[model samples]
Target: MSERREGALDEATIEARLKAELPAWRYEDGWIRRTYKTAGWKSTLMVINTVGHLAEAAWHHPDLTASYAWVEVRLMNHAAKGITDKDFALAAKIEEVVGWQPGAEGGPLEGTPTDPRFAYVKYDR
Candidate 1:
């Protein structure tokens, strides 16, 4: 069999890593993908901008799809033509930032109000 690209993980390794590290993401069609559900259009745009900023800063971009209330992010190392460390790294960061719930952490940052009218991301319970 042809060897995988350098720094690219085998499917088994990728699966294990995803299960252990990023439960919200899945391996599919040669890429690692995650879908973040938002409260509405505003939240969707916020998520897109956040992902864009991080991807640009990391210099590893993901293919994004958005609807009225959800955004899907798919990451792969195009140069390597496989799933590499970069994909996992960016996915982890995206999960961390997008899933953050300061209110649940019991800190000064109360996070967004619970009212539906002001809700942003539909945080995972």
Candidate 2:
């Protein structure tokens, strides 16, 4: 196997960066995590699948736990054994996809799609 990469940020650096860049995420137990609440089971599944797609595309997977109404995502660079730029990039993409609102400027669902099947609500806490 190839040698593990370096450049994992220290805890203090991770904490400071997370605070500024991802306020919704917390550094805990050697991982950066964020929990998103959804409107219901369907929304929860949607969130999970969306995260999975983003993770796969970025090639930086996160640890995920989900219930009927919430999903928690935890990110760390296992090869580096700490937080890295990969984690933050994936997290930002996840946040953007999850928090998108219909009719928002330049949104895919611009003009507000009328289909109830397309509606997915993010629970704000």
Best by TM-score: 1
Per-residue accuracy of model 1 over 23-74 as CA lDDT, tens digit each: 9899999999999999999999999999999999999999999999999999
Candidate 2, residues 77-116: lDDT per residue as tens digits?
9989888899989998998788766576675657435466
Off by more than 4 A, model 1: none
- Candidate 1 minimal-lDDT segment of 10 residues: 1-10
Predicted structure with the largest lDDT when compared to the true one = 1
The lowest-lDDT stretch of 10 consecutive residues in candidate 2 is 116-125
* TM-score result, candidate 1: 0.96
Query: Residue 62 error for model 2, in Å?
Result: 0.6
